[model samples]
Target: MTQTAAQAGRPRTRRAPRRLPYLVRQLGTLVVTLFAITVVIFGLTAIAGDPARDILGQYATDAQVTAFQQIHGLDKPVVVRYLDWLGGLFRGDLGISYQSNGPVWDVISPRLGPSVVLVLFSWLLTVVVAVPIGLYSGVRLRGRRDASLTFLTLIVAAFPEFVLGLILAIVLGIWLAWLPVDSTAVSAGGLFDSPTAYVLPGITIALGTVPYIIRLMRANAREVASETYVRAAVLRGVTEPSLSLRHILPNAAPPVVTALGLQFAGLIGGVVVAETLFGFPGMGQLLAQSAASRDAPVVEALALMIGALFVIANLAADAIVVYVTPKLRDAVR
Candidate 1:
């Protein structure tokens, strides 16, 4: 009759408690954020007046415009149209494009792959380059080398994506003749059709994102380096690499990870500019076309997608921070 037999007789065993409240709160926030994004995107386009009028132009007859409106259901009440649009979203209908006479998702789907590849490559490259530099700069603190790099990061970060893209295009593409001037990979064939063509756009995206990540990491490292544990390790004659890699970095990474997650949203803006500048047919390019034509549905679909991605990035960061930081994990649980 032992404890083992007693336990074996039970139908269930206790399981570890999940951070249910935290998860619920995050999900609630996500829904709110998505709703807000949809509203803003939809409202802004509506505010801009009818896309049918924009498409037809000023010289078009009133009859023609009204016919266009009726055909697209734009003649319905604004509130009714919005409600219908939302309903269609649940059925995977992203709405038809006013300009292209095609599904908005269909228009964006082809470009998504290249954008994913471009952004991911830049993101990885940013971390690879930023981390080591930030680590060294962080440890060096007040030294000349650190100050110089910090100043340089500031200057580079100040430059907009298009400006940097132009500079890189001029230097690497025009002068050196080393790579293609523009990302015409898809037009030429496929993304891998020309490795050289992809490099410039990737570089364009990385430059804008890298500086902030580096600066954030540097700040976090400096703060972590001052922690009591780090000071004690230093006094114990711990090797610098061991102290940095083992103690300081592990403690410092949570904040840097959070900052990195925020940069994903910033990257979307950069993508818009860089993609247009480099002629990369990503969401940015599509966004430009949609905006120019006042294609409300297309714009709404893209805006919502980007907004969801931004929210997801934040959720991921929260999850990562909670997982990696012992204090947060205990608190949340």
Candidate 2:
């Protein structure tokens, strides 16, 4: 009777943490952070230059500039202009791109899908390649294989994304002619039109991120492998594969998952470089082009959109971590 009573109470003590309140608090923080990002974006764009003058060019009369400013509500006080822009966001208006002379969304929406696919492909490669190497290094923990991997990952990590892309372009595209030099030849269908175009840029982005994930995953796996539970499982004569999958992997995954989430932001930056180098016509290339042209509306819209993506990625990661390790629930609040 006592054993039954104790067993029943054990389940109650380990009750899952409430997730709703934690998620609510995180959402609140996300809103405040996004609001702050908007303020900074709007302020920077406001002071950069007069968009009307830039768009209209040097020979435009004062009358023409004034009409353009008034038309875009740029003549309004800065605060009022910001508020109007903020309100417009809620109504799905991203303003007009000075470069395209069209709605900002219409110009960017086409590239959005391809950029997302690029990032996801890059991230998948990072995880698939990094995780196995990290796990193996951790299990080997101070062996020759681990030492060699440490050296190699560091060497790979040292190269900047553009430099790495350039090297790959030279070796694979020029020397061997295995793939096209640039994605310019790809049809309007984007990366899917010729999947080969994605190979170099995708590898470039993944290599840039893989080392960090590998290091973090290795550290976590090593720590988990030393735990009492893992030792006990070993004593029980568990097979190596089963032990790793059942014990170490799950225990080490939460932190790596969180890191992966943060890496998405870095991946976005990589996308910019990769797209520009490869002429992939994704958001990164569009952003670079717009920035060069001093297209304030397009730049501001892209900045906000990118910021939102970063926030959403982190939010999803946090939720996963909390779900996997309920101990983290209190930290969220």
Candidate 3:
């Protein structure tokens, strides 16, 4: 009887070992996120004060506004309109931009690549520069090196993006004469053709993000350095760089990963001010124009896209953490 029970339990334990892919878990999150997004979109549209009148003029008659509403199907019930929009979304149709007088994709797609390129470079720069600096600072906590880095980071973090953009523009663009000062000089059509155009904006955005990553990494590294395994590794003739790179980094990575993901999402939306300051033609500028013009379709589409990107970035980070961290995988299970 004991032998039979052990055999049965072995199979059960083996069956329980199969882990669900992160993508599957994220699919459920996406569904709930989309539902919430749809509700917000519907509510915003319902309470919106006359997109037609805003687009056309205040002097326009009620008939003109009513006609515009009918044309856009805005006169329909909120649920019906939301369903129609949702269906269109599924069919790869985000509907026309009321402001741009063009397809939503036509307006948004061209700008997406530039934003991606800029943010990707910024993220890369942050990781490359921040990780080492953070590690060194944490390792040399009582030294002048750490104190100086912390002071610089605090100063940088205190400045707003717009202020940073203007300062960089004046210092680098004018004083140093290295890059373009205005966005008009930067060609969004060929992002790589003018890498100089991205430098200012990327750095400006990175200023805000790098500090957080550095601080998080420093704190995590400090804690990690005190851990029993790390202390043992240090005492076992392991080099500081080796222990930090192999043990500390991998262990400290989860928070850094999460911070970078959230930062990327924030950059997507936060780029608006910097984009405006620099005159860079990206989704941020597009969304600003859409909002100013009361273009509900474009605004809604942009909002939804931004939300999707945020959710996807976070999900990707979670998935990465689960894949790389055995502890996280077990927790999920």
Best by TM-score: 1
Clash statistics: count for each candidate: 0, 0, 0
Q: What digit string (tens of lDDT, one per residue) describes model 3 on residues 291-315?
A: 8878888888888887788777777
Model 1: which residue pairs collide?
Answer: none
Candidate 2 C-alpha RMSD relative to the actual structure: 7.9
User: Against the unseen true structure, what C-alpha lDDT does each candidate score?
Assistant: 0.83, 0.86, 0.81
Best-matching candidate per lDDT: 2
Models ranked on lDDT: 2, 1, 3
Regions more than 4 Å wrong, model 3:
1-23, 59-63, 223-255
Per-residue lDDT of 29 in model 2: 83
Q: Over the stretch 1-333, how does candidate 2's per-residue lDDT look in tens digits?
A: 999988988865577866667778888989999999999999998888677877789999999999988877788899998998999899999998777778999989888888888889999999999998898778766977788889989999999999999999999999999988787544367558888878888999999999999998899999999999999999999999998888999989878988887787778778889999999878888888888888888888998998888887787777777866766765655
* Residue 101's lDDT in candidate 3: 70
